[model samples]
Target: MTYLRGLARSAQLLGLAVLVFCAFLVTVLMLAAGGMVFGLLWVRPLTAYCRALFGRWLGRDLSVSYRPEPGPPQPDEEGFYRHDSQLYHGPRFPAYFQRVQWAADDPATHRDMAWQLWFPLVVLLVVPIGLPVAPLAVRAVAAWSAWMWRPRPGAKERRRRTDAVLLAWAQCAALLLSAAVQVALLAVTLACFLLGFGLGIVFLIPTGITHYRWLANLRRQVSGWGGGERIERPYQPMVRPQLRGDGLYRVRNSLYKTETWADFNARWVWVWHDPATWRDLLWLGADPFVTGVLAGVPVVAAVYGAFGLVLPWIWTQAFGADWDTWYGAVAGNRLAGLVAGVLLVAVGFWLPPKVLPPVSRWSALLLRPTAKEQLRRRVERLTQTRADAVDAQAAEVRRIERDLHDGAQARLISVGLTLGAIERLMDTDPEAARRLVAQARETSQTALSELRDLVRGILPPVLSERGLPDAVRALALDTSAEVTVHGRLAGRLAAPVESAAYFAVSELLANAVRHGGAEHVTVDIRHRDALLRITVTDDGEGGADPSRGTGLRGIERRLGTFDGTLALHSPAGGPTVATLELPCALSSPKTSTS
Candidate 1:
């Protein structure tokens, strides 16, 4: 019976191979004939069939792990459905496009295409032999199918290492290119200075100084890419030329009727007088030699060791070809050459991870802002945050005023009018007077409720009384998503700090539920080393950008006022984490309800 089953399995495998080949040809032809949508549609069913066959052969259930299809679009307050910021009257087109994008972006779709192309070829090669070899062929094909169809455990780590090596090579190429660019820019700088000082053409000076600023800036950015300290930009903020009341723009003692010349002159003076410009020029002149040696050593050693030494040694030993090239032998000995070549190759691989960090630090020596620049930058930031705080306060006041006018205040006025009516009716009609009194009582209750709600909006009662930990728990209770809070503070934070943190957490929770489509969230709050740290994490489709949303920027400004910082790590398909840190001492422990 076992022998008969093997025979049957062999026949089935051969037949399945032929069938898959035919499907593969059809899919290809459909794709070639301008039917990509149809081709993609054809792939899923084919993958399902193959998965079932493979699973039957392997004796386990195979599963598909495609991303979940997006649900139907919900209409906004204006009764319009939104997809990627584009509003539509109906959901049909948006749904269709979204589905198309979903299919295109899915990794499973590509995996299916790969299986369709590769599986049949493997089966045909293995199963074409006689029955004696058929069982072995079946085993081979099953293993191949499992590897191709299932996710590999080490794939992510391997991919990361591959990416790192590729990035290192790319950085090497960029360094060499930048060295060449530096030499060229040094010539341009000299020409600009010569023209401005020697020939009296002042405009050329700013043009040349500003031109190389981008290269220096790019270096500053990439310096931090791979385990390196980030170098902040050292240049001062440019001041715009201000117009005077006398219908002229002023730059120092000089004034011009039109704004254009004054602006140009200001830029010229700004670039000329700033010490950073000279520093940048000095860096440019020095970088070509310093960075060139740092970047070129590894690449040159690897290339020379592998091609120049190792390959020639192999050729001479294997083929007995007495090639008399100076590069092939080290000091007239092939054995010595091979050992030296292996050592050089080892050095090449080992050097980049060690050297790149030092190179970045070297760049930071000149590129980082000086003490004066740091102080100035701090002052500017404080000024901006103060302005934002003032504006926010003004807006909050307006909101309170509007709510009172529209809600509680209006209700109170109606109650007063009703009471006056009741007094007038008491003597003439007793029944109508009693009804008016009941109406006025209901109106007063509603007005009181509105007043409480408005106050709560200003500062939540839980936050003010219980402190941050309990306040966060109260917040979690209010949100629709499941939230888990961890960690404990020994005591309470300052009132203002607590308020800022509570509101920030509230906003994050709201965003996670409404925008992120998250179902679960975690909030961790702990204080250590005189700093209070809070982290909000959500398992959501995370692509949060501060530039795209005002909520994040508002949180930043609020935190900045207390000398705090907010850091966000949100990848495309991920669990988003937003961390908030504030430097403050905690008071004595508060009595806990928990």
Candidate 2:
């Protein structure tokens, strides 16, 4: 039964292997259609499919987050399209040039290309080499053990000796069959390489690109099976103008990235020579070998038992011979052989299923990334986070400038105009002058209100006067929704971080009241690991999308400048939690004012 199950599992893997092969071919063809400069456009979805497959089948997940592709240019509410030139410091180029330029400038694209180049070989080697060993070994072991304790001297002594010799030969045949399968695997590997490289050299890049799309998919499977951490390179490609001074800045920018070099090294050197690769090779060999040992014994026994049962009947029918002569004369009892064969076949079907988990885990162990790669990935993330912080700060500055110019400044100008009117009317008619003075006073008050709001938007006076903890508590008191503030810092946070935190909370509370329909909100704050953690929870309509609204997006941008992260958890029905983390130190007790 175990052996039968093992064979069934093997059958499933064989089917998957076929799919892998076909996917590889399709990927190559897709790449060839173009330079596959847009290959990632298709490749990412395929990668996701493979990620899902690995997670479901092998318990491995390709946990990768890809940046969204830029969509078509959108017009503002006023029906004007703001060109990227306004945002970017570099001189603008044609839209087509920018698209191609950005695509070429991406490090991930190059990584994709590298992946495409090597994937076919990886799939060709890994699927056949890694998948088949266990079941075959199970068959071999089954053959040896099936005759280990047979009915002694049941027939003539001579017949017994002949049966013993035939059984030995059957056992040898099973072992030889296992060896043949492995040899065949090697032969196929060599043939694939020879055929692929020899015939497809001219089309290598395209072929590789396509193959890589699938190969990455295969790796995802391996990764899931391993249940180990995945190392992702964390660099966003610089999309600065690709043509500076009429030179190819796109190529230059791509070359300049550390991510590009990491990818290049991985493709050309580390992929081949890395210890992780060797470990994968070891898994490729070891998994089948172990599983084969567990399952082979029963499978081999069944094949021989089935053969023994069927051969006699066929021979007797063909020759019109007696049952005893045709069936019993050659080996052992005909009925017994038939029964054994049927039972063995059942075992073969059952045994293979049992080995799947262990085999998957073994595969995973070999496939996980090494420590060095993990550290490198961490550094990459830190670098990207730092860059985001700088960009967010610059954007915040611009936003503040724009607000001051358009809102408070405009209001002050209106106030000045009203004052001038009052001055002109003063002597012409005293009663009219009084009315003008009242209008001017009202205009001045409105201007003052606008200025106060603008100033508060920049940095609330409460945050500076009362310290962060009190400011937040005061914020909760002012909101229409019932709000609670939990946790406290021993000392005050740095002014910038405190201000960022204050606004972030304010925006969230506003959102909860305005859009969330939230009746109650909770703000939980903590100081740990030289970092400030704030969690804002509200009983509200649950769906909160970072991409949908300007308010939340603005909060995110503000927090990002302080190297703060926001993780929003909002389900569709009700309740939302926004967790924000920022690295910072508390001011000393002497300096702290609560």
> In lDDT terms, which candidate is top?
1
lDDT (Cα, tens digit) per residue for candidate 1, span 1-594: 265676777788778777777887888898789666566667677678768877887788777788898888788999898889799999887877777678777777777778878777776677766467666667668768777877644788888876787677567667868888999998998899899889999878788788899999999998985588778889876757888998999887888888889888889778878888888988998998998898878767877899989999999999999865578888889998999889887777667766687779878888889889999988988898888889888998999999999999999999999999998999999999999999999999999999999998888888877888888998899999999999888887888888899989999999899889999999999999999899999999999889999999999989988878899999998789999999998888644321
TM-score each candidate: 0.63, 0.44
Q: Scored by CA lDDT, what does every candidate get? A: 0.84, 0.60
Error of 2 at 119 (Å): 71
Candidate 2: tens digits of C-alpha lDDT, residues 514-550: 9999999999999998989999999999898989998
Stretches off by above 4 angstroms in model 2 are 1-391, 549-557
How does candidate 2 fare on TM-score? Answer: 0.44
lDDT (0-100) at residue 445 of candidate 2? 80
In the predicted model 1, the residue pairs found to clash are none
Could you tell me the lDDT of residue 585 within candidate 2? 93
